[model samples]
Target: MSDTNENKLYGLVVEFGDSNALVKAAERVRDSGYTHTDAHAPFPVHGLTEALGIRRTILPWIVLGGGLTGCIGGFMLQYWVSVSAYPLNVGGRPLNSWPSFIPVAFECTILLAGLSAMIGMIALNGLPRPHHPVFNAPNFERASGNGFFLVVEADDPQFDLQSTRALLDDLGGAAVSEVYDD
Candidate 1:
């Protein structure tokens, strides 16, 4: 039987004392061609996302699609109801009065777009996560306070335990440790 106490590694975690160090480390890691890397800080660090080669989120496109769908659906619903289901000739207005449908379409656009933004954000982030393997790293609790961390996952094609540890050490990381999977 395998020893469960022998931790299954998730990644390599390198803690930095400050955001500046973390940012520098991230840049170096990116430059070194390590793609599966992430950095964490107690608060947002300007330029750090770019340093990590992060790309723009797709949530806006998702919301736009939802809004367009809502707009079309809203307009069609009104058209069907007024022109097909109940033909009412009021004030000499046309049965398919597109002008009257604008307000409902606008409202539906806002509603669906707002809902899509919320849902897309939640889904994209993989939220409701109560746990993460990085939490197993030493002093990880400080991440919400003062710690800044950079992790290179074990699954990275370039990942090598010794080499990564050495690289993190060279990058001025403190308390470099192995992050374990549960």
Candidate 2:
């Protein structure tokens, strides 16, 4: 590929067999002044987030927005139905009864929050993509089995190809591959 293509390609990929090795590699990558790096493992590895310096996700904020929207929607729907649309006066109760609306409001709140969480996660993570350059790495298929992989993207301001490779090498990585984009 051309240099432009290579520049668009980010990160070095290092494969490992165990989570311990992956964690150590992550720490080394972080210490190497790389800011755009990721780790993948077949299973959840405790403390991996902290090692990667990953912060708590913003999903909660999205859910909160959804919940607020749902609250307003549910209240409006109920108001229109019971008062403006139908004007039912049952058992001398007020047409816009707040107590009776609680159940529907609560349910709508949860439903919208859940929907927002799913959509937010997918959008934030750029899900449903058909391809990724990392898939081109040899032996990367093992990532879904027992292998762990760490990728430090080249877009990081501190990334220098040779120096990054040497850093990974010194960290005991068995192999490091440059990722490319088309």
Candidate 3:
């Protein structure tokens, strides 16, 4: 494909020789004020997240909210049924027994927490991404193996084909190539 206006530009990808080089390139790209960038490596590379300037996620708070909702809902349901709806008196026991409600409320807490964790992770990470534009890069398949790569997304305000390519080259990146949205 040609680099023409007809082609939707995804971004530019640069393959680094090693983790150190990848980290350096990422730091440079971040320092150059490129906000939309990603680093790919076969395995975890220490300090790469910091180099990319990524912040912490709020998934834990989401799960906590879900769990609290479930617990309250479950307890109220049981309360309404036992104390108000039916009010069954078993063996002279008090109708408003709080102890029995604990088990169901606890179970509800666990269930909703687990469900929220799964859903939150999917939503936060933008899952179900069957394909990405970077897959169009040459030799990108190596990214799952030995390849270490950094991509500067065209969405970034500072992203320019010529200058970004030159910057990647200056960072000692090899096989620096443009990735198209196709």
Global lDDT scores for all candidate models? 0.89, 0.83, 0.90
Lowest-lDDT window of 10 residues in candidate 2? 1-10
Model 3: per-residue Cα lDDT over 1-182, one tens digit each: 65668889988899987999999889999999999999999999999999999987899999999999889999999999998999998998888788989999999999999999999999898988989888898889989989999999998998888998888889887878888887
Displacement of residue 87 (Cα, Å) in model 2 is 0.8
> What range of 10 consecutive residues in model 3 has the weakest lDDT sum?
1-10
lDDT of 1 by residue, 1-182 (tens): 12348767788899999998889899999998898999878898998999999999999999999999989999999999999998999999889999989999999999999999999999998997889888878888999999999999999899999998888889987878877886
On lDDT, who's better, 1 or 3? 3
Compute the lDDT for candidate 1. Answer: 0.89
Report the alpha-carbon TM-score of model 2 versus the true structure: 0.91
Quote the positional error of residue 10 for candidate 2 in Å.
Answer: 2.9
| Candidate 2, superposed: residue stretches over 4 Å from native | 1-8
The alpha-carbon deviation from the true structure for residue 85 of candidate 2, after best TM-score superposition, in angstroms, is 2.2
> Candidate 3: deviation at residue 156, Å?
0.8
